[model samples]
Target: MNSSWNPTHGWEDLVSAALVGTDRRPLPSGAATPEAELFDHAALLTVRARAGQTPREGRPLEAAPQERQPEVSRAAGDRLARILGGERPRLLTEWLQAAAARGHRLSPHLLPELLDQAARDRSIRPHLGVLAGARGRWLAGLNPAWGFLLEEVTAPGAAHETWELGTSGDRKAHLGAVRAADPARARHLLEETWEKETPQDRAAFLEILADGLSLDDEPFLENALDDRRREVRHEAADLLTRLPGSRLALRMAERAAACLHTENGELHIAPPLACDAAMERDGVRAKPPRGTGERSWWLQQIVARAPLEIWPRLFGRPPGELVRMKIPDWGREVMAGWVRATVLQGDPEWARVLFAWDPLADLLAVLPRKDREDVAAGFVRRHGLDGQLIMVLGGAAAPWGPDLALAVLEKILQVSGTQPWNLSELSRLAGERIDPALYGMAERLSPEPPIQEVAALLRFRDDMLKELQ
Candidate 1:
């Protein structure tokens, strides 16, 4: 009865008996289970053994997925090119795999035209990262195909994106070496080509800095704070303020301190007002009016660009006073706009302060869930839905209806759970209100899970039959 068992599980006694007659001799390394007995005598590679399997514990529910970048970009780009160049469809995928093995960068000029041709042949498509992410130039945003790369690189697996760094004798060790202190170098590299890069490429390249902001990039970024292109200036300034020590912080603080005061034992500065000469020279430009004051949208942008550190100094008092200061009645919308800006910049110390303001709190408290849903939904559609959707789910799902979440799930899950970073984000975003159905789909789609068909995912299909009763 050859068997497998842990050597520590009283296997010696069983082995002695088996050797005498039952032939159940345990391997020196393993228990006396029938398989282990065979392993003992069969010159098996039963190196290490555990006495028992660990029991399973439940994990949280569904999270919208985050897509991978780069690796999938390489894969899809190569495949689409091969198909466009007239290879068989199957051969295109094979060639793509081969190209990925060889480590090739898709020629930016060739990728789109190739994708267009492949589309005509019906062999390649949106699946091609090189095409989907190519905003006619540099790849911006996550390609649904490659979204798993960062997740895989950052954390090992707890979710589907899990991968071993240097197994299988691949080139991962070299890749790891290059990525060892990647954050700083990569930002500099972007700065190197910032001027020559197209507007789309500029946006794409600048966004990468956001993923891993470093103070080391501050000098170059500060130069960009006043860039001719508004988009470049906006994103660059935003990234810099993320680092608390930058000059913008001190400047913003100066402005904020100047704004507030308690005159004769009462508050003075108006809470919201037009960005008069004092405000503009100070960096608060009343612009882009969506209402009575400058456009709420423009006010949001300028406030977001002005460092939160400025508020205390600009007001000549603390945030509590700033919140209490009077404003042109219409300024309520403008300040609320500023509060929303703080959320995107995501500086907690500042957001917490703004978050606590009674006026800001009141607006959020009474705001319609539908309005928030619509607003955020607009962002999701504009940006890639995968990562953003996960963020929303982690928060109050609210009365926005299950359909919004379901749509986000259906759209984003197609690329979920393949990478490590995405998995970590997924876990964070789903929090406790995870949707079980989405979780099941994630499991089934897991790279390690057995392939299974999911009936509910009819999102990507082009053909649907409607039966009218």
Candidate 2:
């Protein structure tokens, strides 16, 4: 209240009094300031200072790099908002793929949100780089949360430094980038530090080999089979299996050939007597899972890792013919291993044959999408409505064609009343994957509880798809 009182002179004293409590350390007493008046004045000044505060002007942000593509339409932007808001996140990958195919860039305002989304869901990151455009990459450089994106845009020289001196994640990103550019070099880089890396790090680095997998990588992978770590051995075996001509596959094929043969036009299989040291060295685990016979477990591993080409040559029959032949109980176990191998190797022709023998979900997914749908359609028609058919259909890609859609609808209508529980999950899958064009067909279903719920979900999905479009 004094005309010439400077608040700065007693500011420290005032803060100390406030910290220790004015009861213990009474407010500074002076001619112009009584304790009661001092408290009131301090309160008034605090309120005034807070109310009068203004944000300091920051330096202007640098201009964003020029975007090559035009911004997406307002409708498309709105669709992205809905997708990011979790209305139908499952369709995000499809939407991103579609948008990237159309050569449209996301709106500038959405770049941060999209990058944040990519950070949380890494599956979308590969597609996001292109769709996010120049502005997104520019924004990513300024934010640590989004720094992963910068790896994609960084210069080759700078990326090399990041790979050499940065954290494990940064190094992995650099390795991925290098692998995409020159696969052999990536392998060389990893090999340089292979001995120094921990077992877990070694296993993780081995995964990068999958990116540029080829017969050229076979020798390194074959040597990795003898790694001290079981995981490294398993990973090496998995990669080697992908290369039919790899030495490991040849050994497996030879082992499988010795165990399996056709006798008098019927298949016969002799399970391995023991999991020998050689088999274990090649990545076969010595211990069987609980309740599994040791020989059967060993046989499964041998057959599953053997190259698909081995069967037709060894049995002198095409895959389709061999799969249909009658097999002894032990032979069935061997065939199951072959089926698993088909899925693991992604041998579509073998998968197609095995699916015909037994329409398993894993085999179905391995076949080409069109072949998968056709096979599923046939199975649905032959077996009538069942859980297996629903599973195959559920795993198939979305926007189910007219024939598959109608087949599914007919099957749903046929069994809706009897299998309510199965139909509940089937209906949900139908909503997610069925073509919106089949709305009228879905609407025509009888108003039973199952059909009613499915119809509602279909309508909601239709709306969600339309918004995304």
Candidate 3:
């Protein structure tokens, strides 16, 4: 016996004897049976370990502030529970958005689960400010994990004290609120502390300016282009490029004008011979990616950053006519650059023309909601079922109107027999996107497994949304 062995200090010795067996390592005390003695010591150790500690007294918790907004319908809370339980979890955002829109707060029982969900998926956090209400914020203060709830609450015209003393997120939310209300004031406020801010903070604060960008911001953005950090310079140049009249845009337009021109009703090509220092300063990268040629990269950057309006003026044609014109050489490169410009400038005229030339999914963002469906349906008809067709459909606005729903459903049925495998993704998209009102029509589409799955999902969504109301 190791006379020193006791429950308080020799727990490991007791465990070692039990692990090594009675013959190899004797029990702490010679007894009737080694197993019995070992069990007795382990039991005593367990009891001592549990009873030795008392529950430490915790500070009294502050009561959660009362939430004034009415609670959502009992049915809606049950639907949220089902969503949290993994029944169509993607619809959780829709449930939260709808509940908040109707001025309803979540029931107290569901706040923890939802806060945990928002912690995982940031996209839903924006909707939580209203839906989670005052109680959620109070709950967030007690737990570090739910701190996002506190950050999301931007009191209108937040006091200057938040910017001066609050956490990083608090300062950002405060600056964003000010920016939303007055762009110039936000700019001035940021300038006051710009020199003191770290590179990362400078870059993040600069992005908030994007929400309400104007010509008034050009001087500040231009100064930022000279910032020591590469990220700061990159962000500044991007903002300037989006501002059509910025000096950087003008430089890019001039450089592009010298490279491309029209003659004999065909567009000509003249990519830059070299990427100059000025071009680099204005945000053009001199080095190309692994497979891209240097001159081709320069050409793409020049055309992309140049204002889209420049084409109509220099080419003596509207965007539609210019997009249709032949480009004998660098055809792909030129069109690709134009596509970049269309997205950055958000030129619907150019986006419409570019889509007519080539039905790109990226162009859909600039089109109106109705136009998106119309153009996407037209593309599905013209291109038929293929990878590109699926890519185009992905960009179209959801709760897809009848035209696109019918067009896609027809396409799915038309090709179901020949291409059952391809129909799965298309069918899933249809089920998820097509308006719930059209559930009956979708159910009648076909008896094929993919179509049947689509019908089932549509019906589920229909019921899901009804519960929210």
Candidate 4:
């Protein structure tokens, strides 16, 4: 009898009744969705309701159905070696076609081999439009690894294409990797397509290519500052601004130095100043500084152009003493920009001094290190006991480089008082710049609860040491 009727009993009651009847045949759960499968089992009914007709004895078996998409198996990728086994042209062309047909998201597991092998084949390469031209650039557009092929398939294929292809693959990865692996070679690759790409693409490509953005990349980036595209100009400007060590920064530093000076025991600068013809010749320009808030404009251009090194000397006689000096209302903001420049240059000593001036000074220190020691000490001194850093450094972590910074730190946190500010502010000052010495002093003077908890962490020394007795 075909039944098509609603029952007064709920699914659980029906299952219990069926269980009592001894109808033990298992339901066809493999074809059902998980929710439907749950309704078919008497065992679940017993477990959920805490009542069973017979005593519950065994754990229920998990029943997750296998997902099926037969055509796009991993083997579909591995079979490329044999599917067009003998046809060279067919082998090459078909591979590209297959990938194009697969839409943009290549099966994640097979993508590496697919990209390496497909890019090497010259004939398959010429037809690569199957992604850009045929697949309609949509697939490649979404995937940075493939989107890079835009210039490659259009240009000639050479072994050097590996560098071009490999580096361009940076779209998938971040600039940090490309910058780490040979900054010069990557910069040159961008230069080749500098004029050809759309202004939008050009700006973006340069932004990624901006890895290891050193003093050398300055001239070219400066040239971009004048590009017709505002975005291109802004990106170039943004990078130069970030580079506190650049020649542009040096020039701005000199200009800003001229403005700070003597007045009745006060540092003095009126509301505004123009980037005279000389400043403009040197790439510091202010257009009609009258109405556009000239003081801010002059300050922005100068701070952006100035090298961080000028701050201490420009504002006062001694660099160390400047730590105590304060510029009235606007001077601190103006000086803060100078500090950011110092941090961008990745100079520890300068960052240390600015760091001394204000605890919040740490934000400006977004630096990189050629040798880990530079940043490592700062990290340990600041965040040595921080849970995240401890996890990142691993178990055998011993301090390396500038161990003295920790001593400096121990003295600082030792200062008495309940964290003169906010808890969020404490998290910010952690990492390399944290001082183990200050941590020690803080512990010694007034033990914080978290500090005690951190001290209580389980440690493992060789049990063999105990066995020696």
Top candidate when judged by TM-score against the true structure: 3
Stretch of 10 with least lDDT, candidate 4: 458-467
Candidate order by decreasing lDDT:
3, 2, 4, 1
lDDT digits (tens) for residues 1-469 of candidate 1: 2344443444455556556644444244445355555436433222211111222258532332332323334445444555556743433443333333333334455544544444355433322332222232222212222232222112121222121232111122222332344876565545565676666546545666666666777787777765667677667766765665777655654444344445564544434444554434333445653444354443444455556555666446666566566664434554664575465456444444554452232223223466444444444454443543555444435323344444444344534544323443433333222233344444444443211222122211101111000
Q: In model 4, which runs have C-alpha deviations exceeding 4 angstroms?
A: 1-183, 207-216, 238-247, 263-265, 274-294, 311-316, 361-364, 367-469
Against the correct fold, how does model 1 do in TM-score?
0.39
What are the models' TM-scores? 0.39, 0.64, 0.75, 0.43
Q: lDDT per model, in order?
A: 0.43, 0.75, 0.82, 0.47
Winner on TM-score between 1 and 3 is 3
Candidate topping lDDT: 3
Error of 3 at 195 (Å): 4.9
Tens digit per residue, CA lDDT, model 3, 130-210: 678788887777666777777663332346788887656668878998999999999999999999998988998999998
lDDT, candidate 3, equals 0.82
Q: Residue 23: error of model 2 in Å?
A: 26
Candidate 3 residues lying further than 4 Å off, grouped into runs, are 1-60, 100-104, 117-120, 128-149, 153-213, 263-266, 273-277, 324-329, 440-456
Residue-level error in angstroms, candidate 3, position 20: 12
Candidate 1's displacement at residue 433, Å, is 9.3
List clash counts for every candidate, in order. Answer: 48, 0, 0, 17
The true-versus-predicted C-alpha distance at residue 17 of model 3, in Å, is 15
